[model samples]
Target: MSLAPILLFTYNRPEHTQAVLDSLSKNKEAIDSVLYIFCDGLKENSSEENKSKNKLVQQIISSENRFKEVKITIQTKNKGLARSIIDGLNTVFLEHEKLIVLEDDLILSPFFLAYMNDSLNRYKDFKNVGEIGSCNFFACGKEFPTYFFTNMPDTWGWGTWKDRWNKFNEDAVFLYKELEKNNKMHAFNTYGAYDMEGMLKDQIFGKVDSWAIRWQAVMVLNNWLCLYPNPSYSNHIESINATHAKINMVPPLQNNEPTFETIEIKELKNVTEAMQLGYSGKGDYFGKLSKKYLKKKTKKILKSVLLFPLPYGIVAFFKKNKPKK
Candidate 1:
């Protein structure tokens, strides 16, 4: 079997980076797989504290060689996460036919690499299989197949073949315009739980920078799909220190190791009721809603505490307009 290389992207969180590396190294295929670590540089005019963390991350990766072959790329100029990932994928895919990808905050299950490599080989020739993901955020019923297909692609811990990845368009405008021209806006949103069109629009206006949203657009435009192993094989830590981190966004689902020896791949044209529930914010709606409520409530409370020096009326004004979470 040809082992796909592993590409890990990291920024300033050294502790999270170390924890993720330790979990990855525990994977059975760790010793045989090639590891490619991309350390993004500090953004221009970044604070001293951020620069310090970035340096620490670089140092930690440099000292580790857990995989069979370790390759490190340090960007001299800050290429934000999205650009760094786009560049890394293009460069690495050029060398290897397939590769597994991870970020600093995601911790892998011991079986993650095995499942990814197995699925990669199983569906490599299937033009519809764009990528294989280790995490399944959807709370599909306990009885669903151990592995299944969906049009949604997850970026947490994933792998893809060169051909599937080559379809990605870096130009958000190009993708948005194409989708708009085709009258596929509504269809794209139904493909997954979230509003992909809105995300693409944000990307176009520079409100947010994300490579996954564009990739999702490409997958929808090309009628491609992603395969996922039920019971997530990876856990997202979502470090509080990471910039723009949305902890528990989609919240991690239960992780279960499968008993099956082989994965069966097939075409799934429609979203399963389970997939819909999971993605549509309805699968685990109550639990997810509770989490969001708590997070928002806590943030508001913290703000109130921080502004205690203000007049009682001012704080009372904030309390009065508080939206029900």
Candidate 2:
């Protein structure tokens, strides 16, 4: 079997870059696989501290030679995470039909490469299989099969074919319009388990710049399924300097080799239900209501206060000036 090329994206997090690299180098197929490292350039007028950290990260990747082949691309200008990933994937896919991807903040198990290669090879011919992912955020329990399918794609540690990746539509406006036109917003949000629609809007409105959300939109719109190992093969170690603030308590990485099989393309019902409940919220009725509904309402109220502050300021002044009863 031809091992898929591994693409690693890094920025100024030296410790994260080094830790992920060390864990990846220990994978069983690391010696046989090709590794491509993309070091995004520093932003304009970057602080000296950031520049030094970026240089350290570059130095770390320069000395690495554990893979069958090592290729490095150091951008002279910052392309941001979205542009960096899209551009990097485009470049690698030109030579390889399929490849595995890793960011700077994930630790992989020794069997991570083996599982990715096996699944990628197994599902390469299946048009409906959009991605082979190693990060399973929800705990579906031991009853779940060795591997199952989900409508959402996981980018932490994933593999995909060039053909499928080509279908990724980065146009936030187009994606949002299509989802609304088709009345698939509810389904796109994993039955209200997540707020993917809001994220898509954030992307559209320039509130956030996230490639993963766009990628997820692509999968959801196409009705594609991403395969995930029961016991995830990757662990996301949240960094102090991480871009996003979502902290997930990922299940422990699978220490032993994982078993993969060719399952039907349909998503496992039990697993999907579990994911819905898990992502809906933390606790009971109030938790769900607060997360699913009140959060958005609160954001609107805050935005209103920020936008029209004079009236709110007057009220605040009067309340403060009024005697404390």
Candidate 3:
């Protein structure tokens, strides 16, 4: 099998970067793969502390040559994650037909490279299949198959062909307008359980800068399918200083070795049963209770901290006013 080049994007987290690289190095195929590391520069008006951290990240990447070849690119100015990824993928795809993408926080299982390369080779000619996702967040119990098809594409750890990626629409406003005109907004929201709709609104309104949402929208708009493994080949070790920390829906299940040699590609339109279990926020008690419960608990804790004596006094007053039992 011809190995796909690995493109890893990183910021100022040196420890996270090291851990990710260490795990990747453990892959048997990684020794034969080429790695491209893109280190995003510091933001404007950034503190010296952040700049130092960014340097540390660069140093960590440069210190390792775990792959067949490692190339590093350091931006002079902060291109931000969205632009860095967009530009980095664009630059590398020019030289490579297919590539695997990863961030600094995702730790890979040993079979990650095998799965990605095998899937890329298998689905290279499948026009409707857009990307192969290595991480599965669905808590579909322990009785699931080895792999399955899903409509949603995940970014935790993934791979794609240049042909499929060419369909990506970078302009959010234009994509949103197209969705609105075609009356696909409802379907889009339904496919992602309102998550895609909210992300599109935020991206267009300048409330947030996201590239993954836009990529997913482009793929969905074109009716592309994503292949997902049942037991995820990667786990996201979220960074503490991350500006946008995603809420984990379930505990990541590990699969160090998974075989897809004889797996058939089944294009599923509505795998409602499995998808419903995947999105915790859309169907169950955990989804309903997560945000509201956290908010109430935080408020009570703050009240106790700020109005310590007052809260206790009020509690005592309320108890004293109760009828004797």
- Which candidate number would show the highest lDDT if scored against the true structure? 2
Off by over 4 Å in 2: 283-325
lDDT of each: 0.79, 0.86, 0.79
The residue-by-residue lDDT of candidate 3 on 152-216, one tens digit each, is 78788999999888888889999998888887776566554556787898999999888888987
Q: Per TM-score, what order, best first? A: 2, 3, 1
- Model 3 misplaced stretches (Cα beyond 4 Å): 248-250, 262-271, 280-325
Q: Residue 312 in candidate 3 has what lDDT?
A: 82
lDDT by residue for model 2 over 32-74, one digit each (tens)? 9999999999999999999999999999999999889999999
**In model 1, which runs have C-alpha deviations exceeding 4 angstroms?**
191-193, 244-271, 285-325
Candidate 1 lDDT over residue span 1-325, tens digit each:
6789999999889998999999989887999999999999888899999899999999999998888988999999889899989999999988989999999988788888878888788788878778888777654335656677777788889999998888889999999888888876666775545687888899999999999889988887887778876677886886566665564544444345555344444544433555555555554522233455467779998897777756776778989999999
Error of 3 at 88 (Å): 0.5
lDDT of 2 at 217: 79
User: Model 1: which ten-residue window has the lowest total lDDT?
Assistant: 281-290
Q: Is candidate 2 or candidate 3 better by TM-score?
A: 2
lDDT of 3: 0.79
